[model samples]
Target: MKLSWSVEKNNQLKAHPDRGICFEDIVAAIDHGGLLDDVAHPNADRYPGQRVLVVFCNGYVYGVPYVQQDDGTLFLKTAFPSRLLKKRYMGGDDNGKKS
Candidate 1:
């Protein structure tokens, strides 16, 4: 399965590649559909869309794998390692603010 991580996530994993990706198994699930069943429901409609996925770096990490409608392509959108995982990974903030 094809998967990727962001530059920041790459650095974080570089520190400990062994334990860097506890959710590596998620990669397999990417192609098979919710193999890990860890992704939360979507809270908003935005770019990149929300889908269920198993993140390797940590529970804080959120990722989306998609099959391209153009040519039946499938790839990773880069694992996002952030506290944003709690909100379906659309990038927002506290105090009721959306970014």
Candidate 2:
């Protein structure tokens, strides 16, 4: 998976020395270990057509914010740890067993 980082993302990574989320982790998520969110965030007005990919790594859920460029490259806008795990991705009610 190829990802072009935004300036903010680079800065965020630099500012947070303890956070383990990195380029390699994002690549892994894109390739084989993540979920493509059906919901596109409306909050990111700066990034038009932004999409979110959620990945579970090291017991944490990372929401990777990105956009697909016209040239077909994925531009990674930013990422952060999510407070709640999305139900579908976690095999919750709609996807899993029903009581």
Top candidate on lDDT is: 2
lDDT of 1 by residue, 1-99 (tens): 434445565455446533334234445434544433445335435544434454533333444433334343334443433345535443445323221
Q: Which residue pairs collide, candidate 2?
A: none
TM-score of each candidate?
0.32, 0.64
Clashing pairs in 1: 23-56
Off by over 4 Å in 1: 1-19, 22-24, 29-61, 65-69, 87-99
- The lDDT, on a scale of 0 to 1, for candidate 2 is 0.63
Model 2 lDDT tens row, 5-88: 766667676577555567566667656756556357657676668887777655456677778888888887666666554454
Off by over 4 Å in 2: 6-11, 14-18, 36-38, 44-46, 86-88, 91-99
lDDT of 1 at 48: 48
